[model samples]
Target: MALLLTANVAGRTNGRNVARLLQNQFPAGPRAFRVPGVDSLNHARGQPVSWLVTRTASISGQELFNNYGLKPNSELILGYGFSLPHNPDDTIVLKVGGIEGRWEIGRDAQGADGLWKVILSKFVEASDATYEDILDASGMLQEMLESLIEKLPEEDIAGNIEVRADVVEMFHHYLEGMSNLVAEKPPEARSQVKMPFFALW
Candidate 1:
């Protein structure tokens, strides 16, 4: 199954600036490339950025900005298209800023399009610590697991009472561990907490 991951980043950067940043930061490969900057990359690397973009020569950076209402210091939506094996156990990991999260690859509620979509939100940057520290924090991990279980269908919960209870207990321990870790950190080294949204289509 092919998945289209879209990350909408909004800060003090414009679309063109963001496009340039992606062109440099992202790997030089077939599956990843910037929009307007893609033209040059395709010319130099002999790789096609997108079929639609190739077919339509009129598509340009300015056109994308105008179409999406992207302006100076506005939110820029970047997309990455990739393929994955069609399996229920498969999961997709999303990393933004300094935060990372994951979601199982599955069909949506309607399931009409026959495509798998996994959406992960609440991504934020960590200043004083690594992404693993924030993502693996006891409270954060518990919240992530609870959110995943809550999304499960009620019919799927019939035989998982014990397993769910176990997870709850694990969450409690994680919270305790995280609290200790935080207490050990100096007050000046602590970072403010902020959550950003990330979505996949």
Candidate 2:
């Protein structure tokens, strides 16, 4: 498995400063490299520090615990990698991922003031087309919900309930559409087997 470690230091910081900070904070293991940031590759250019931990290390289960002091079967890696600086204006993001799992450290945009965020994400491959489609649909649904919520009056309880009902109705419609598709095709010709409605929920 190929493991990648990346660190992005934003606001009044440079790639050199980030590289030095990581080196001082996590003195162990191979050194990290300073590379140009690819977040805005087409329009704006940026320089971000990053590290390729290893290409062959096992990142699954007990291997992570034995190698990086991480909890077994969990992708979270805290108190082991580089430490975050104590500057409020500066934001530092750390990401580690491989074929087995992925993890990230940053700030929570939706949380309370000064709240830190640590995320353990599941690795999804590009070849998993169905999973990718589901993720895309989920993102679209989230955007629709956010737009609807923003237009709703905060003091209106009935409006809130209406929004909830709308979402539920949309879910029911989706299930009904799926059921129609299944009914239109023979069992052997169906792309996917029909799952129980409760299981889908």
lDDT of 1 by residue, 37-120 (tens): 422221111222332223223323523211222111101111211111221122222232344443212222122111111111
User: Tens-digit lDDT track for model 2 on 162-184?
Assistant: 45544444344333332222222
TM-scores for all predictions: 0.17, 0.18
Candidate topping lDDT: 2
TM-score of 2: 0.18
How high is the CA lDDT of each candidate model? 0.30, 0.31
Q: What's the lDDT of the predicted structure labeled candidate 1?
A: 0.30
Ten-residue region with minimum lDDT total, candidate 1: 69-78
